[model samples]
Target chain A: MTTDVLIIGSGGAGLSAALSAKEQGADVIVACKSLPNNAQTCMAQGGINASFDINEIDTHISDTLRSSHGLGSEQMTRTMCENSAIAIEWLASIGVPFSLDEKDNLAKRFMGGASQKRTYYAQDYTGLKILHTLYDNCLKNGVIFKNERLLLNLIVQDKTVQGATFLDITTGEIEAIYAKSVVIATGGYSTVYHGFTTNGIGSTGDGIASIIRAGGVASDLEFVQFHPTALKKSSILVSEAARGEGGYLVNSEGERFVNELAPRDEVARAITREINNGKGVFLDLRHLRREKLTELLPQEMKLCRLHEGIDMATELIPIKPAAHYTMGGIEVNDSLETRDIKGCFAVGECSNAHVHGANRLGGNSLLEIIALGRMAGINASKFEPKTTAKNQEQLLKDKHFISGVYNFTNQINFYEKREFLGKILYHNAGVIRNEIGLKGVLAAVRQMQKEFTFMGISDKSKDNNTNLVEFIEFGNTLEVVEMLLVGALHRTESRGAHYREDFNSENETFRSHSMFWKEDGVLCASFEEAK
Target chain B: MIKIKRFDRKKEPNSVTMEYPITEGLNLLALFYKLKSTLDPSLSFTGVCRSGVCGSCSVMVNGKPTLACSYTPKSGDLIEPLDYHPVKRDLIVDKTKALHTLNQAQTWIHKTNNIPRDTQNLHRIERQSNCILCSSCFASCPVMAVNSDFLGPFALTRALRYTTDSLELQPLDTLTAIQQNGVWDCTLCGECTAVCPQGIDPKMDIMNMRSKSVQNGFDDPTLANMSFGFDFTQGF
Candidate 1:
């Protein structure tokens, strides 16, 4: 089917972009692997950050820049700063209710990096409200949604983009969707870690793999944000809003760990240090007003109350640093257009515009989606679809070249290997790293890569093979890990989320963004100085 | 071992079966599918995203409202529909209203010029924006059981989300809508919060809204008119 724009995700970015593109007179189709709401965006617990009356745009902007460690673009930062208030207003027009302050204005609350209250939210299920609202609006506007179609590959023609091919899980049919422009908003790839702040099932980074395989370079693959507190066992995120509302981090010994109000990186590092030192970390809500705690996060508190038999309002909730947001992805320019791919763009977690840089602030990630999703959608509408007649020849050659990946007679248990890879990445390239561990990780990746060459899939069909698909994704993850190790090895500085214990000093040279990619299977790194 | 039986109110009358001797790894969803094949083919229920992100398969398991997709079934467990809503059939109940009511309450942020050309600012309440609309909050809400117009915790939570976004410009209208029949309706009983499988706190959004509303001179007249408004509802 021919579409004006094919959005390859149903999360906030894909849905928002599809809606905007449809409004711009485009035939938009939001292709989702699961139901519209089943994406990881719906599992988010914190509120969106936008400038409301309680704070100026500068406060939010400065907070974001500060969180990014001087790596965020000034123009992009300013643009987002100026547009946040109006975005909230537009959402309100769509029936997103804002909790009020004493003046009947939107209630603004303070979070991690922001200097003043700017975050607006519904009670806690803000993501749900936004998803449902957009989904309903999309239905009303006649936007087509192809749900449960697992995207397998993008059919690129020449230097221009064409469309995507996907496997319909219900019927196991390989359906082709041709589009003028494609948007990759498939979210982050946090499942590369053993236990993550992300819902593991949705961490495949499918959109990203498709883009990268189409000659799009994924940059800054090393920077991953680790949330300071996740439920110890389940790794379910305990929202930053918890600490924003006076929750504190404590040690197993019941001592306050770090500045309860520090940036996410600082708090996460502090807790990680404690865990490394044999003192398990816990998030203490004991001193906070139980009524207020229960009121702000009723479900989280209830989980502690019912499942753990500990009232989070009165007790300390055990926690640890969990692998969270990815700060890298398919490289895109200022307009969210993928470099070298004229008709392709990326948004949300899958795009590395470097807005979040080294680490992202708590409320800002949501803001980025609304801001970037709209921009990418609006900008991509101006693009003219290119005929990929010649590009088809190149695609055929590339396919022939990579056919060996599927033709190997050997096989490794990808699921088991994935688990091992996750454990190694978490232990070596996790919150704290050193040259020795990174090198160790590269060695491990090589060993896994060697083993993966023998990995065989049970299904040989081109139409549908989940095991094969997973194997391919696992390969992408392994390929990406080499860059992470290289980035970590080159930084040699302790700053933001990338802390190298061996070179523990906060060096100015390492303040820049570590841009990494692969050429001829060799990992390379370049430092882009922070603006 | 004790065996428990559950019937589908929609498929067939008295289509009950022994659900125990259930495999150790059996969940509520597995039990339902078993009944579908063994008891009646016409048996229908709701489920999507069996991994628990979708809250469509919520049922009363062991006398507690739980998501059938995630909850493991037990011997002698009593499985039924949520307490407040009328059962549509067997375990499925009317979920269409909860999400619609949330939409009616303007549970999302309305923007104007702040429509971000980039996604950076849209992330302010981005995580909270990930609600699956499972209606577990409605099933768990104490106020919604007696007063249908309470707006409940989920709707109120969604309403408050806009107030929390950094991009929202018109806080007044959103807050006003939230304060009216939305924030003021929640009893702060914590039932909705407790039952939320996603760990979202709709009750807290209500409390935040109440505080914000009081700050805005929108007092809960229901609380104020306790001597008068209490006359309408006899159960309270």
Candidate 2:
């Protein structure tokens, strides 16, 4: 079906962007690879902050800048900080009943970066509330939601986006959707790592891979944010609020090792260091306020206390660092429009809007998403329709490019590649990286990329074939992995989340974004000083 | 008392062990299911919807009352039947007494005619209706755990669905019956609401029932005293 705009990914970002586009009188269609709430955004347990009085903008902005370590864009950072309050206000306007303090004011508490109480939450499942609210409103406003449609390719012609081709996962039918504008909010590639705070589901980097193949440059691809604490065996995240509420990180010997309260990167790094040093760490939540724990963290606390047998009122919870956020993605400008592609916008975690810079502040990811999601949507609607005829030939050329992906005999399984890629990334370019490891990963990924080209596909005909889909996704993941390794290899210093164990010191040379593009199947990298 | 032995499943010399206080990740429901599936097929416990929504799995996992389905069984948990429920066998507890009390109290509104639902706002109450008949709220309530005859939070919350409806023909009659042993019994400590995994605000429903009771002049002396923060440090 034809539409004015088609938004890929039904997370908070995509739905919010669709709503914004609809608000501007654009007939928008939100398509998802899964159901609306299936995205990782709904799995988010902690809370999101907007710089209200409870969470002061100055402290929030300062914490964000501190995490970015002078690598974040001043403009994007400023815009995000300024717009956060409005984002929270908008969430409330749409009927997300945020939890309140005793005085009936918005509840706020310290988490991760910020020194002030700024996080607005609805119990522990803040994302679920926000996502359900946005989705319900979208339903009320008559925005069409197409579920289980995996975005396969973006149809681009003449340096502009035409539309996207998606495979209906349930029926296995491939449908080509034509739109004047397309917004990609397909989240990050964190699942590339074996161990992560993200769910086992949501690892398809469809938007990033499609955009990259369509010739969009991916910037800051190497910096991945690892959360300091998650449950021991399960990937379920133990919110940073655990520490913010006076929980302590204790070693195997039950001693507080690092500065109990420091930056997330520092704390996470310290935890990693402790683990590496044979001192397994645990979060001691035994002495925290019981009433507050029971009230605000009912679900998570119940899960921990009932299953773990260790009462948070008096026991140390086992913990470890797990991959959390990616500070790198499709490079977008202030308006969230890709630098080279018109009628194409990126928002949320998928776009490297440079708000978080090198490392993202804890609560800032959610805030930046809504703020920039709205911007991309509003800016996309303002675009005048192209006064050109429907280029059927160009459309056929785009179709051939997508068909080539389906037909390509590159029979690489993304799960296996994902496993291999994750090991390579974690082993080499993890919290601590060195020259030798970087070069090794670069050599390894390039070899995979090479072998990936000759991989044969038996089923070229695209019905709802997941095998073909997996094959294409592997190629895309490999393509992005090449950029990630290249970005990691090119940077000669430590900054924010990208710490080099060999370099060991934060270098002045690596103070901006590393942009990568593929030319003739060979990945090339360039740097742009932070604007 | 039940003799429950849990295994670590990790390859170690002492893998099999006894647990207390519901060791981490061992809800009675999951533990019982796991035991029955891989350990012994004949071992049975009652449960449905394994999500905390279904209250059927309300058992004491290591002494503290909680829903077994959602409760992860931890090591060293002293799993048992709820303090006040009839222990059937193993982890199963009979919920007939508690549920029967709710029914006899006429916990639901006696509808003379079906109120026409607003088709436009259909499923507005859908989220609230997502409650699985799990009595976790009943188990968590101190009053019900002590005085089983009290028209517990779960039943009262269900009653509010009918009594508070704008379309109900006899809201007062429904409200009066529920207020007798129902709304006033709640301590407002928010234990039931807090234990609810579905995010159903049972406390608010009980409070609404109290307000409706007060409006109809059928409010209990204890409720009026508690509302005004009276000296209730001594038992009524």
Candidate 3:
């Protein structure tokens, strides 16, 4: 299939881009692994950051920069923050039923690290509403949706990325699709935690992996943001809305060590410290009014009761930090275009704008995604269709790589090895990192990579085989995880989400973003200043 | 022991049941993960957010529609794909036909007037907006047996959401569209309300839309044709 613009994922970023591109008279197609509106955007429960009448844009930018520990690009932050109100208006115009105040204005809330109540919300299920509205509008505008198609490879030749190859999950057919321009909005890699993450199963950094393998650069791959308040039992996210709605965190000693409204990195680190000290960390909503809690945070209430068997009115919910969002992905420039690959733009959690440099502020992700989506859409829609053919060698290589995962039979089990990968990465490269632990993660991942060559996939059936699909995601996770570890090891400084125990102080020499890319078929990492 | 009923069209048996040690958890998605990884590596299912929010992992447990990532499962609990839809593979039903009702019903807001200034009350539509589209309601609705063209619960609720919206101008167009196989076709068995994970009462939404349909010039087709009487088959 060919179109003017092909969006690889149908989350907030992809859908918004599709809509904007369609509005620009470009024929657009959105291809996703699963159904649309089922992506990671709905997991964001707190709200979207936008200042209408409450706060200044500069204040929002400062708060974001402070959260990123001064690594954020002020220009990009300015672009996002300046256009945030317009983003909110665009979402509202598309019929996102944002909760309104008594005076008939869009209601807002305070998420962690926000200076004011700037996060516009639709109760607690803010992201869900926005995502659904975007989807509703996209469908209304006749955005063609190709569901259940997994992106396999980007069609990159002559230094211009045109389209991609997709494996239809149902038919088991590998088809190459071409577009004038392709937008890789496939969200994040937080699912590397596998079972212990707040992300959807499909958040495997597929877009970033495909982009990097297509010779795109990955920026700040080290900074994985572990949310502070996932339920200890199931890792289902207990949103920051819980804390924003006056819930507080307490240790086993019944003491609040850190402010609940501090940035997520601080809260997560404090919780990890308490856990390391053998004190159980818990989120207490016992003091909040029952009616208020029920009205504002219905999802949190249900999650706590069903997942943890705790009623927020009576008992404290046990909490653990889980890998929630990846603050790093395929590095995109100010135009949201990849520096290395022309015509291949990235957006949302899958693209590192260097706006949320080291750590992301809570509500800013939703804001930045909309801005980036619009930017990419306007830029991609104006692109003239230039034909480019993939070299036979590259096509054959992808075919071989895809076919081998199904045909290879060995004693090594990918399932067990993946479980092991999650464990080591979480314990070592988790919230807290040190030289020894980072190196340990490196060594273990290397062994896992060696074993991956001989890994056995038990499922032989080709029809609707999630066994093969998940195996592909596992391979992508392995590739992205290596970049994360290498970037973490090379930084050698404590800043934002990348906390180094041995090098516990932030250093001026390593202020730039940790950029990773391939050099002659080998993975490489270095601190590179933004152009 | 836990047994998963797998369905593949290419396979001989049409459906096959495989057993593994019963693993208990807060939800069955984790149990399925343990089952798939350890016992039978070929077991197919889609589990995204185990938190019940994503609505991807809906299945039938013990012949009841349930979100596999949200509902707790026990030993000997029989799991299957959604009841009425064709199962693409094990526990993963093809939702294309079911999800198409949204588009068919034109559930989007169609504003006929340019009302620039606005006063809004989110409480009016907040409940309807919470739908996660797990298709559990569509799966459980007995009305689906008689009317495959029935707009289903989620689509009707969405129509009601727009009808009640202060910004929408063409509520009548929406209500009229949902009159046949849309709102009046529902049997109001409350199965949709029972299975909804988001606590969205599509049954109630359908009931409310029925009143609005009458409030406008639209009538329940069964009643419009008949002289007078309540039609249990064609909802109140």
Best by DockQ: 3
Instruction: List runs of model 3 lying over 4 Å from the truth.
Output: A53-55, A241-261, A284-298, A311-316, A388-396, B112-121, B227-236
TM-scores for every predicted model:
0.72, 0.69, 0.94
Model 1, range A290-408, lDDT digits (tens) per residue?
A: 77776778767754543334678666788878888888888888888887777899999888877787778777777778778888888777688746342344334434533554586
What is the full ranking by DockQ, best candidate first?
Answer: 3, 1, 2
Tens-place lDDT digits, model 1, residues B1-236: 32433444333555564444454544566556554434432344555434465566787766667887666666677766676665544454655456556556654445544443223334444444555667777877777767876676666766676676555576666687766667776678898778887667777767777887888777777777578445665685
lDDT of 3 by residue, A378-410 (tens): 888987756655445555666777788777775
Model 2 superposed RMSD (Cα): 12.5
Choose the strongest candidate by TM-score.
3
Clashes of 1: 102
Error of 3 at A402 (Å): 2.2
Report residue B145 deviation for candidate 3 (angstroms).
0.9
**Stretches > 4 Å off in candidate 2:** A52-60, A253-255, A286-298, A301-316, A387-414, A453-472, B1-236
Chain A TM-score values for every predicted structure, listed in order: 0.90, 0.89, 0.95
